[model samples]
Target chain A: MTEVVAREIIYCDICSFPPEYCEFGGTFKRCKDWLQANHLQLFEKLYSDDALAKATSTLSIEKEQQISRDLEKKQAKEEAKMERELQKKLASKIIIKRIERNRRKHVISISGLEVCNIDMKKLAKTFASKFATGASVTKNAEKKEEILVQGDVSDEAKEYIENLLQEKGLDEVKVEQIDDKKKKPKPTAP
Target chain B: MFKKFTKEDIHSRSNIKSSVQRGLKSKFLEQFPKLEPAIDNVIPKKSQVILIKCEDKISLYYVENEVVLFQHFDDLVPSLRTVHKYPDCFPKVQVDRGAIKFVMSGANVMCPGLTSAGAKLPEESLPKDSVVTIYAEGKENALAIGKLTMSTDDIKSINKGIGIELLHYLGDGLWKLVE
Candidate 1:
């Protein structure tokens, strides 16, 4: 059997701050060794022996780094969330439906306004299927156009149309004008 | 690395702060129409100012002192930002009938024609209706700025309501021309 001898460790007798310097000739290194030999009584009261050396009383560098990263990610997430919400809310108001009914033929017209600044062709294409029910828009060179219901448009239906237009920012607009003398919609060849 | 602040940046910031203050002041005046002295204090001297580029449109609010502020859509929070981004998309439909400037669809918002409402919000949301003074204009009649009732979406869907409860035509058409 071989006999093992442990090396003698030195501890500092100093202030609460980490011992960076020494008055004596020898230098002290490693907080764990310093705490164990010199301040064993204080160490026992402050923290458990296994954890005492690494535990810092003040803000640690690692903790600070984590806090900064978290703050940045939060800000970015908030900005992205706001952008997404804005797009959703804005997109909802762009389309409106107008309906007209006649005994034989019905005509519903949707017009493009200068202020609306929408892609008329794209909008026209989007609702082309719904517009199939006698709905069409005529883009006049000088004036704005509307979806004309060839037949009587119910109050509820007209209200819906007006709401869509208002959401799109077209103020000073009038809807649901009844043509007392109904005219047949221009016939389309299938 | 540090980037030096430019003269333009300082100028713009000052102008924006002052303009915001002015706008807030005007809003206060509108609320207290009877306070003559208070209103007069808020109005700045016309000659003592320089032109500020508000919302990219120029205005002579506080020029001589070089404290002009530009009011952009970004200055406003969520609701205003939503409308400013797409002014023409909602609340308006083109007139199929010939010879009209534009026709409003009372779908999302109600304008001019005061009546019943269809949206969830009540009439109190409408900015108090009043005639305001038109001070300036932007490109293609963009209505540089005006006090408005309800958010843009509110006006569009309300079947019976005054969408633009208070409109100050910023340019020529604000007041009737004396022929």
Candidate 2:
């Protein structure tokens, strides 16, 4: 008991559960394939022909069939949900807007990042240090969360966002840049 | 409790003093004495412990970005990741294969799941509201954590209704949060 050994459990890359518990996860098929490809020995030990037969519960065959059928339905629904989310990600675009704060100063506000799945606060922190300027996450007039960077770094911000999306395998995602100018008052002639 | 937890839900995070860390470790050990030997390994002496306050009164103790435990009320319950590491340290109950999917989907543990053949209630019946690590049939790792709504003995006799209120489960929001 004094040894204090902590168990090292291997988790499935797809579902993030220990391999033994992947059957209960929504992405069991992918998890199983990953386990099979990465840890063939463990995969065989857990999911091989006889292992699967023995792993079956004491429940009646009909009940087991019903459970498997229910699981298949759930898995299909999960797949459809993920498909819709991916489509949404692909269809959406990232917008970097340079808003004129004053005659000489400008601030960049990046929005439409709902698809990237990156943390806004963390990205803002990175932008703050990377550009050596004030950066923060704030809600825009549209009520969507946007990263507001002080100073005009619209192109740089766009490149940064594009690179971020690239890292997430979303290279096809569009990073749109735009400029916003405030209307100026004209002197009235008496 | 962490079914819908996310990073945005966190309100504040502050590192605790070493003395407080020692106290937290001791308090955790006191609750689960079976963890006496592995306590130091899990919560290393020099490791930083962060107290993260989140929405809805949930407070999590982060040991190097890994949330070792959390508290919603008086009792401090270990996260499932911690439970998986030292599963034997906590009192345990098993849910039958039939209930595995439901439990994975964050459902409460019903009496039938605990009373069924593939399932097991500990020999020494635990009291109401005691934290229990939930294992599933033929599974090597603990799949969930729950508090007994009814005593183990009562669950065996009553054989109906919810036996355990599930707090955290594999693949739930909290599980994905740290990962």
Candidate 3:
């Protein structure tokens, strides 16, 4: 059986050598030096900065300025869009409320703090120690994990969270006060 | 169980000598005779093997772009983990849904968990102390790798006690090495 071998041909203008064998001759540097010594005119024409500038002179100054302005506008628009998205994300309000469990018993429920870049367990511990009450990280009825602090500490917790956010440089965090007591309306007299 | 490795350490460790690599390949093959064909596929020729010794007597084997295998003091041979990239490169034992959490949390594989209703085992029984990969039921990849405490035949005969001693599992230090 006869074997057929297929070979690929690659040519470099400066080196005038096959691409595979070009490395053996120490890249195009050797070829450039040879060209500089033997073919001065051609070397000067090919390697000169003036030739490069002339080759790229097709675009007028006005066209170049317009292209740059367009690119800058596009980049500015992208940056603005990214900033808006970041604001939207950070604007997710951390909702704090006081939930009445029974007569004279209340618990402060803090939600949406999970979205913030803070440890939930450590935050719970801090709340527990700061308020001298039992605080725990538990999932609400909606299966959303939130921090629950014993007693009506919404106002205190809200201030603390805001300060914590500010200290962490998360000034964009918005705290929303939600009163769970007002959620259920009293039945009208019939 | 792990020490921080610098960029220089990684470079020096990865450039293992050819003779040493060959010895490692042979040792690995001898330990798992079933992986003879797939050995070259997993650790290909000219592939660099990096052995990083950690604080807890565990050796991390970084093969090319992936963390392929790990060895512990109690382990007679190196075992493959999920981070190895190539699934089914080694022998596998699928555990039940209830056992997935424990396995991922680095708990020893109990016989009851493996013999549960939904669990699956290989038709060909593996010998005791053999390196085996543990896969979760309904999952496509291996979750942990361990050494079988008892032979597959004995495991089928009995229903209690630890069946596999976990060496490496998901979220273990070795799993986080590549990251």
Top candidate by lDDT: 2
Quote each prediction's TM-score: 0.19, 0.95, 0.44
Q: How close is candidate 2 to the true structure, as a TM-score?
A: 0.95
True contacts kept of each: 0.00, 0.72, 0.00
For model 2, residues B1-179, the per-residue Cα lDDT tens digits are: 77787878989999999999998998888888899988887888889999999999989899977999998787789998888888888998888888998998899999999988889889998999988999988887899999999999999899999999999999888899853
- Interface alpha-carbon RMSD, every candidate: 38.7, 1.4, 24.2
| Candidate 1 residue A127 C-alpha distance from true site, Å | 4.1
lDDT order of candidates, top first:
2, 3, 1
Separate DockQ for every predicted complex: 0.01, 0.74, 0.01
For model 3, the superposed segments whose C-alpha errors exceed 4 Å read A1-190, B1-14, B73-84
| DockQ winner | 2
**Which run of 10 residues does model 3 chain A get worst, by summed lDDT?**
A18-27
Off by over 4 Å in 1: A1-103, A131-134, A139-157, A169-172, A180-190, B1-179
Off by over 4 Å in 2: A186-190
Compute the lDDT of residue B56 as modeled in candidate 3.
Answer: 49
Clashing pairs in 2: none
